[model samples]
Target chain A: AQSVTQLDSQVPVFEEAPVELRCNYSSSVSVYLFWYVQYPNQGLQLLLKYLSGSTLVKGINGFEAEFNKSQTSFHLRKPSVHISDTAEYFCAVSPRGSNYKLTFGKGTLLTVNP
Target chain B: NAGVTQTPKFRILKIGQSMTLQCAQDMNHNYMYWYRQDPGMGLKLIYYSVGAGITDKGEVPNGYNVSRSTTEDFPLRLELAAPSQTSVYFCASSYSLDPDREDTDTQYFGPGTRLTVL
Candidate 1:
């Protein structure tokens, strides 16, 4: 079994400022991590994912995340934020192999204020 | 390709009513899933299908049913709808994971269906 925990429920940041969304997971076996973004009134979109190798992974919309096994965290970061970057972000995890059940965190609303 | 499509973008059903949420994908993916997202909460899987003629339950399968008769369509049925079922429903599809490849398995989603049970 696996579960995801997103540290923040809401994150407010000014335009052009850096931002980070923290996510952690717990599982007995190796797991795959993913970050998804949801715009208003839309479905979730894949921003990035970490399967193996390269603890640091980059994703669409100029976003990136680092996977820290020891800390059991996959934190998403953006160097600079744009007003368009404001959206709900979700962190999800699924077990290795053919398992397709993804456990997701509650979510974090990233409000980029201009 | 249409990617993923869900009908009835919005709906309002009275308690104990029944309805079906339609989801279709043109990507020819082998895996399809149903998930519901409550306000401020993450999405929870309701049901999933590995392929045509095979279905399975997920984290939150109660009060929901699904069927996969074709590769392109997987519909979710809500029996005796309740207020608790009022949420945004999303249908997603993804290619099966490959053990040999380290690339992360990604799921593509539909626009979503917003349901309100009054």
Candidate 2:
């Protein structure tokens, strides 16, 4: 079984400020990590993913994340925030060969203040 | 491609009532899934289908059932609705599930269906 933990429940930040959403996972086998964003009253959109290769993965909307295997962490860091960036972020994990079952974290509500 | 689409943007169900949540995708994805989103809680998979006529249960599949009759549609059925069944339901699809395929890492989601059970 795999599980994910998002450190903060809500993160409020000012526009143009940098922000980071911490995520940690636990699994006995290799896993794939993903970050998804959900706007109010909408479904989730894939922000990025870490399947393999480089530890640093860049995604859409000027978002990037670093995969630290030793720490079992995949924290999403965005250089600057915008009012439109306000949304709920979810971190998920799918163990290798698990038939695509994703274990998601509670989620971090990112509120970008104007 | 219209991606994934779910019907009945919002719904309210009385206790013991039964309803089917419709999900369709134009992307022709081989994998389709049903998930529920609760406040402060992340998504929990209820059921998934690898292809037409092939369905499987996920973590929270007790109260729900699913059917995939075609590559484009996967509907979720609730036999007996209860208060706990109230949540935002999302339908997602992926082109493939082959680990070797890069697209397998991402899933496209629908607008979602908000269901309230009372």
Give DockQ for candidates 1 onward, in order: 0.71, 0.67
| Candidate 1 chain A lowest-lDDT run of ten | A94-103
| Candidate 1 pairs with clashing backbones | none
Candidate 2 C-alpha lDDT tens digits along A1-114: 989999999999999999999999999999889999999988999999888889999999999999999999999999999999999999999876453588899999999998
Per residue, candidate 1 scores C-alpha lDDT tens digits across A1-114 of 888999999999999999999999999989888999999999998899887789999999999999998999999999999999999999999886544678899999999998
Off by over 4 Å in 2: A97-99, B97-102
The TM-score obtained by model 1 is: 0.95
TM-score on alpha carbons, each prediction: 0.95, 0.95
List the RMSD of every prediction in angstroms: 1.6, 1.4
